[model samples]
Target: MAGPDLTLDQARQQANLAFTASGTEFAFGDAAALPLPIAQMKALSAGSPGVETLHDGGLTAEVLCLKHAGRRWAVKRARPVCRVRNIEGQTSFLNELQRHAELAGLRLPGVIRPVYGSLRDGLVVSPWISGRHPGVLDERQARTLLETGCALIEHGFFEWDYSAGNLLDDGERIWLYDFGYCYRFDPLTQFNSAGHGCEHPRHHLAERIEGRHLFGALLDAGNDDEALPHFIRFKRLAAQAYVDLADRLARRGATPPVLGHYRGLAARWHQELAHAPGLLYLASAWQAHSSDLDDDLRGRSCTPRTLQRAQWLQATLGAQGHRLRRSGALSPDDAALDDTALLRRYHDREVEARRCQL
Candidate 1:
């Protein structure tokens, strides 16, 4: 939606005007009962500034905690120069402001409520949610996240990022906040916003949860004796979530291809659960965790979990090369290699990955 004539700053200013004209709720100047205008939130204090500043908040903006008058709010300020540099990255802050305009009134329990936002001011405000990222997800959390993802899908919003940094669990429920990567898509007749959501059936709600959050934690868990049981538990929950998602989407008049996508996913997991469940888990965990790790490294956003996953992959390739090969997680060339060769290959990659470790 940005243009060459319009600088990023100009584009942002335009976005703010567009949203304001549409009557989105905005709090400022002692009207909405805030301690400060959204723009001034970044300077809440000298060094504190009340910024949450999540490491995984992506490269476009700085997320800060804002405490005003007796209440706390999250005031995300767009960096003067976005770190991402790509068109999507360059325009993400504006995108989030626009998305907030659409979501400001939707009282979805799983979705975070947007209080106010302004691209001109380079900030958006929302209530601050507090909770730990329960490294391991239980059924309740998994169900909540997947169901909310499905709701977003049904409503034509396709969210691309589901990283741990974008979510919070308040013990009772999992809350999704960031909308920087969220885009529009057709839910009934087409795939996600990319093409038709059906073309890449692999990018499901459950898949996002596993790749973004669950698999990384399993690395922290260590060893198959422990990780396998944890995965099996989640797989069972995922299977059910898929069933419920498919049913809900079906009633919403989702197209056959779309419905088939969800149902097929459920059937595969259910079928595998009845038979080759562990094999399924091993292959999935390896692919999900490994791919997610590669993503972090590519983004130069390595976390403690990223380093742990690299170590785990190296050890697993060394200890169970045959099983990993059979799981089809490694590349075909690597899989065809002997145990010693495969282990060495992974070890070298692990070493490179560690170089960027934080």
Candidate 2:
């Protein structure tokens, strides 16, 4: 059967109206009335046996835990008014459901299976992932998680919301949940000249570092000093990766948005490295606590001090070129300074250091 036909905005309005009309406090019960097949409703109830009324968190939407077909699932409904400017989350969630349904049997978590209705006020039911939110893992665990995450990203499983709270660790293994904002990262198709095709670069970088640092802190048992270095290295590596990806896109004649994101990230990293040298050093020192040192050490061995210096040099080169571009006074010699070359050198040096240390 075809799914509900409604724009995210329409869905949001319908959800809000349903919430108000039902007077059920939580919109879950009311949302259920948004026209679903009787059989599907019965199946949902059967799947989530113990669900009845659920809690409501006042945000863009209301979420409810329900029992359908003897299984428990989360039902999220959008509000009536479009308070949030970007409908990315709503769109991404709908996309995940569609994509995951097509690629069933993958190890990844289930999407909004049986989508039962439309994007707005829709009922998405996936098995609840069990375990506490993932934090920094010990050296062994961190390596495992990082490799796993990288592999996932490479496979086009880019979860825009990779926060610690979104990850659940069941002691034996880690399962990613809350994939409402996940997207397929297509290097070729998903680039523009203004910025990357995905979310803002700063938001992406901040979320990535926050997740990595949380992992680092967990590995160090909440010792900020010990986790500092890992945070620095993770940030640098992430920024480098972003810049490299942007360069590749630029070479393909991608839009300025794509290049802009990379440039922004590179500039940010350079600024941080120059002004907050101590922070980077502290982050590197904390790398000792990463569970993934073996993977890091498998490449070049970079001292905290060296990484900082290299980052500063690269940033300076980039800033000079940017200034020239803005002022329309870029000399051939100044333009000759290869930003990509400097970035590669820093990347290789850091990888080598990490490998050696491991």
> Number of the top candidate by TM-score?
1
For model 1, residues 1-358, the per-residue Cα lDDT tens digits are: 7676654345555665566457555432221544475435645433564543543345777766666566777667778788876656666877776666776666666888756676666766678888766677777787777778877876777777877778888888888889998876677776666533445666666777788878877767866678777788788877887678778778888788878877787798888778987778877877786777778778766777776777777776766667777776676776677787766766676677778765
Model 2 lDDT per residue over 1-358, tens place: 2235553334544554454456533211233433345345334432354556553533344445665465555554444543334454324444544444433435433222333324444444445544666555444334444544544443445555454545566675565545555555554444211133444333343345353345434343544456556556655655666666567666777667656766686776667676874444443332322212222343233235334433433453454434324432233443454667545654565556544431
Off by over 4 Å in 2: 1-49, 52-55, 58-63, 66-72, 75-85, 89-96, 102-106, 109-121, 139-144, 187-223, 226-358
Deviation from native of the Cα of residue 251 in model 1, angstroms: 2.2
State the lDDT at 302 in candidate 1.
73
Q: lDDT of all predictions, in order shown? A: 0.71, 0.46
Error of 2 at 228 (Å): 4.2
- Model 2 CA lDDT for position 24: 38
Clashes of each: 8, 49
Model 2: lDDT to the true structure: 0.46
RMSD in Å for all candidates? 5.4, 15.1
User: Model 2, residue 157: displacement in angstroms?
Assistant: 3.8
